[model samples]
Target: MAKTIQCTVVTPERKALDQTVDFVVLPLYDGEIGIAPDHAPLIGRLGYGEMRLRRGAEVSRFYVDGGFVQVVGNHITVLTAQAVPADDIDREAAQQQLDAARGQPASTDEQRQIRDRTVAQARGRLRVARQAHP
Candidate 1:
């Protein structure tokens, strides 16, 4: 059997997952990174995208808007500003949010920031959906 690493995914609201996983694919700001047990110690800034975790023959998917990943020894932890399981996301609601953000006027700095984040989250949600079905 392949060596496994302790993986944890967390957001401010809750701890999403904690398990021994064979491998993980994360969307860093630069690109996608594949990690496994005993991987070289590293840390990365994540972008809006999908995170894939594999354990044996099972795979789990999550959507992350943005965050950071830390790797040390046999442990990999992902801390994200926003995240949700792909299966738990509501596609229709996501689409509505995307549309609403797009329709809003570029009036204030705060509003623009929110709009940008909403778009990023929508894209991440879309990526997770595509990856989950593929």
Candidate 2:
């Protein structure tokens, strides 16, 4: 049997997930990072993308936006602004958000940055959902 580690995912509204997972892939600010049992302790800023957790043959996916991850001992905790399961994501709604973000005109740098982040988050949700289906 594969070894497992404690994994917890939380958002401002609620606790999204808490379980023992054999492996996990997180979306870091720079890129993706994979962790397993006994991984070195660390902390990192997260980005907009899919967070994948696996146990045996089953895989779970979530879309996370702008968070922080902490790894200590054999436990992994993710604190995110938002987290949505891939199966719960609405493709049409995500597409609409992406379109709206792209269509909006940004008058200032702050507006542009927010718009860009919104677009990225919407795209990430769509991507995760599509990947799960396809």
Candidate 3:
């Protein structure tokens, strides 16, 4: 049998997931990172993108909003603003969000930052929505 790590994903409302996984791939603020059993403990800033967990031949994917992750021994806990099943996202809605974000007036620094964040979130949603499992 493969070694597994306990993974838990949490949002403000509730615990979204709790499972044992052989491997996990998470989107960090700067890039993507994969975690295996016994990985060195650390913390990372999460990004708004796909989060994948695999156990044997099964893979589960979710879209995670930006937050933080904590790794300790054989456990990984994700504290995200939102953790949504990838298959639940709507492609058309995501696309519309992206378009609206792009068209938003970014005349001030604050406005530009908001627009950029929205754009990134929309893009992430669209990407996940497009590749959702059937």
Candidate 4:
């Protein structure tokens, strides 16, 4: 049997997941990271991308918005603004959101920041949806 670790994912609205898994892979601000049993203690800033959890031969994927992650004593805790099942993401809707964000007026610095964040989020959702469907 494969060894596992406890993992919890939380958003402001609710707890997204609480399970034991064989392994995990999540996007960091700079890149992706894989966690296994006995992972070192650390904290990281998460990026907008996929969070994959593996249990035996089964793998589940989710689209996670920017947040933070912590690993300590064979447990992982994820605190994110948003988390959605990859299969639930709508490619068409994500694309439309990206387009809308692109068309948004970014004349001001604050507007530009919002537009950029929206664009990134929409793109991340679209990417996950495409991967799930493909």
| Tens digit of per-residue lDDT, candidate 2, span 1-134 | 66789999999999989999999999998999999999999999998989999998999999998799999988999999988888988788878888988987889999999888888888888888788677
lDDT of candidate 4 over 22-80, digit per residue (tens): 99999998999999999989999999999999998999999999999999988999999
Q: By TM-score, who's the top model here?
A: 3
Residue 79 of model 4 has an lDDT of: 100
**Candidate 4: regions farther than 4 A off:** none
Residue 126's C-alpha lDDT in candidate 1?
72
Task: Judge candidate 4 against the unseen true structure and give its global Cα lDDT, from 0 to 1.
Answer: 0.93
Tens-digit lDDT track of model 1 for 1-134: 66799998899989978999999999998889999889999989998888888988999888987899999999999999877788877777767777876887768998899788778777778767766654
lDDT of 2: 0.90
Locate the minimum summed-lDDT window of 10 residues in model 1. 125-134
Candidate 2, pairs of clashing residues: none
Task: Show pairs that collide, candidate 3.
Answer: none
lDDT of 1: 0.85
Writing each residue's lDDT as its tens digit, candidate 3 over 26-122 gives: 9999999999998999899998899999999998989999999999999999999999999899888989999999999999999999999999999
